[model samples]
Target: MNVETITKTLNSLDQLQRNTAIQSDLFSIEQTSDLTVAAALVKTLENLGVRYAFGLFGGGITPFIASLEQSSIEVLQFRHEAGAAFAAIESYFASGHPVVVFSTTGPGITNALTGLFAARWEGAKVIFVSPCTSATQRGRWAFQETSQYTMSNTGIFTSGTLFHYATTVECNSELSEIARRLALGVGKLGGFVAHISIPRTIQTSLLTTPLPHVNFSPTLVTAGEDTISKCLQLLCEAPFAIWVGFGAKDAALEIRQLAERTGAAVMSSARGKGIFPEDHPQFVGVTGFGGQNSVLKYMQEQRPLRVLVLGTKLGEFTSFWNPVMVPSRGFVHVDIDPEVPGAAYPYAETFSVQSDIGAFVRAILKYFPEISRSSSVLPLPRPEREVIKSHLEGLVRPEFLMDAIQRVIVENSDAIIMTEAGNSFAWGTNILRFAAPGRYRVSTGFGSMGHAGTGILGAALARNRKAVAILGDGAMLMNNEITTAVKHKIPAVWIVLNDARYNMCDQGMNMEGFHNVDAEIPSPDFVMIARGMGADGIRVSRECDLEAALEKALALTIPFVVDVIIDPTRPAPIGSRINSLIFHGK
Candidate 1:
């Protein structure tokens, strides 16, 4: 089995045969002799539908990086390991496909932990590939040694909370088992994060055994007929409200239909924006952190009998476990993971159902009559929109900037919008309105500062269209991949709120009666940084220039940046955050 012969054979196959060979039971053919462990692993990942690989190339992980370059998977060399991991997570969300994040050992491995943890928390399918020290160099302090002697092998190299499945490839014999485990893990419902670490020597070792043949079929959990009937009965018994989360994104259509049929007031978690059209008549405002005051008003006034929770864990960021959100009849919560339903609101009576959000919703839709009529005529609360006129001289207001973005970006284009953690998240969640799913992405679960600033490149690349990232200056300065984006000519637009401070912390401190918090930073000219990195950029100091700057950034074919100098004095809508902090005695 020579390399040239294998290439010729693959090239000679018909399109149908090639598709079948690559997608179904890829390892059944005799193809191990010509491939090394790294090459075999790359092929396996490609067969598993991994289209992109992002990471920094180091000596330890050179073999895998080289293999990735040779394969059909698009490879990107990021500026930082954490940025690469964040990009990998966004790539999955954008393409609805699993992505690979590669790294070297020791420091590279450690730097990528934050993004990997976020990938798990965000419920994404991401495979982490890295290299470790060889068995012979256990005690000796090799440069950046990653072995039992230097690093803790418990969570990094072994299966635990960090990864759904993890292992170190010690020999060629373990390749089949590893491939099998990965196939199963990725095929299952919900997020799957797996890590494979190979020693530098073992990476290039010729495979002795063939990779396992896996006929992988995705496992979709769906509710039974009885369960659907029970849920329907609960809904019809009394007035109910619909609460949408990020996990129910795929089921947006069904959720919308359900809401319309029941005439139920709908509210979404911060990350769950756009699942149901925010402008719909039955729509309420977003709930939880950076949420609207309208939601609280609706809860106090309308008081639905039971709330139907979809796909969210009702965590602190979404629910704050606020007693006001709890209804009289309790919750009929649905999620793929059974543990999630009761864990968020343990005291509340919850009827838990373990099922895929879309499948369950589709099943419920099937039971409905063909000519479905509205169930109620109660007037619902709608999210408030304020019209603010710009001032003559001072720095730009965030509200004015958001208004421009909403009109220019959200209303005009189909580009995905992402927001970084901090005041940026609060502003975007509170102001920007979306009417469709797959257009908004946020990481409330992990809430990493630089996640969006660095991840927008991957999102834009994967979506094959423009993607906008709204981030604070702290995040822009902390971590960004503008250089990598310029090199690849990715159509990513970064809108940085250049207020020269960690405004969220600053504002929160003021509200909490803290003085002189020192959360300020001397901000840099982000436009100059973009220009230096070979990307185009614009700076907006007045509210009048925001729409034009946004339009200019969106029109650019290459990577672009829009830096907005905002007024830090105007407090963001973070009163709920301060209340939550005070409630917890922080």
Candidate 2:
């Protein structure tokens, strides 16, 4: 669509929002607690029902920060701008509420892009609010000169954060316009819609007039009668498989019922991790990374007739939009945001229905095929556990450690798990068992290192629960915010998959006979480091030592780290694109 068309749709949507009364008088901004611009922003957020706010607020956002303290909203202050933003993203994904990240100009705004990238890829509906050099600084290379729209659609994390649907809120003269826009776009758009490019002058300068009150409670998008009928007919006609992602939260039960009703095996992106109970017999487990061979094999053999994607971009980590596994045979994608259908997975011969995935699935259940929800779940029969276990152990110690994590988490009633990048990521995705919501935090999109340590801190802090972060040895040393873990008093458990090498890079080079150089890391004794950093640390070299260390780590109320050392030689299967990039030099 052209820019004019975009604006037209936005205006119409804005008008629609204003006509709809807010669910409560709670959404009004007629407050006496110092009506600063920041305060106005805070009120707007409260209207949106923002449960958690994370980010560093030093200069520009102080008024909002102080107001937050006075109000019921809990602010999670991070050590760095990026950390704070990432944490906000974490909060958004965990809870289906908007997370607020406040940052100053220049360095603060620049640092936050990575976190926003993570949010966009993970399909988080978060706002990254940063101050632009005030109105006075335009035309001058003042501190941080950014176009809000650019930040929103940087497309760094995933391609889903596309350019066409981006919006930038520049004028406070349009505060009501902005609020209504946020209500319509943020919740309805599905991915990230940043409220950015806030002119510094406008933020600090007193408002010349009262902020306009505009109501913006969203009307849940629903499928039209004809569309619903056509969708049901399409499903009934095909060998359909359901693929759910982060957007699948609301549609979990509906998707499950649909899967049962159609006899379609359920598949999910890593971000959608536990939407379908992993233990469910029909759940084919997560796709991408070193996902499941059994699941992949099942897809290959059954050759599903229709690939039903609800609330997922079906991103590259799902194999760069591969057609071999999921062909373009009547792919049905249901998303609340229209942008998702237009941008990602456009080549799947798709039918993009504009409605919320969960709501759509719920509505469609009445018409779908009938399958069983309770005919006894058949667990993939233990694949000769002892034989496979012995082979895995003999190939590399890392596999057994991976095996142990799966076993332990499966045993634990409620486990919150985090995995850092590199080989351990492959292992974690392959092994982790999620029990409930807010259970896992792995960087499937960015896969950046040093994330698991601090990221787990965010997860644990958000839930105030115990979670194990399995970090590869090399990745753990990047950002030693072990101090944050100590400071927050978060019960963040770190299980270091210690190979002392960038195993993925090393293995890639080795396969190509290119003399795997500089890939090895100095195997550090993390136990001593953790102790030095005031965190409890333990080491496990033998397989038997694994259970004891995990038990000890979980027993502690404070942060704990377990360094599980393994040989660097073992190969953890990675994607073909990474293979092409590393081996074939593509």
Pairs in clash, predicted candidate 1: none
For model 1, state the Cα shift of residue 406 in Å.
0.2
lDDT digits (tens) for residues 367-422 of candidate 2: 55365455564333210222234332422377777777766664663657777777
What local distance difference test score does each model get? Answer: 0.87, 0.65
lDDT of 1 by residue, 543-567 (tens): 8777888988888898999999999
Cα lDDT of candidate 1 equals: 0.87
Off by over 4 Å in 1: 1-27, 369-376
Clashes of each: 0, 3
Global fold similarity of model 2 (TM-score): 0.81
Q: What TM-score does each of the candidates earn?
A: 0.94, 0.81
Off by over 4 Å in 2: 1-34, 57-64, 132-174, 197-204, 211-214, 327-330, 339-348, 369-396, 435-438, 575-586
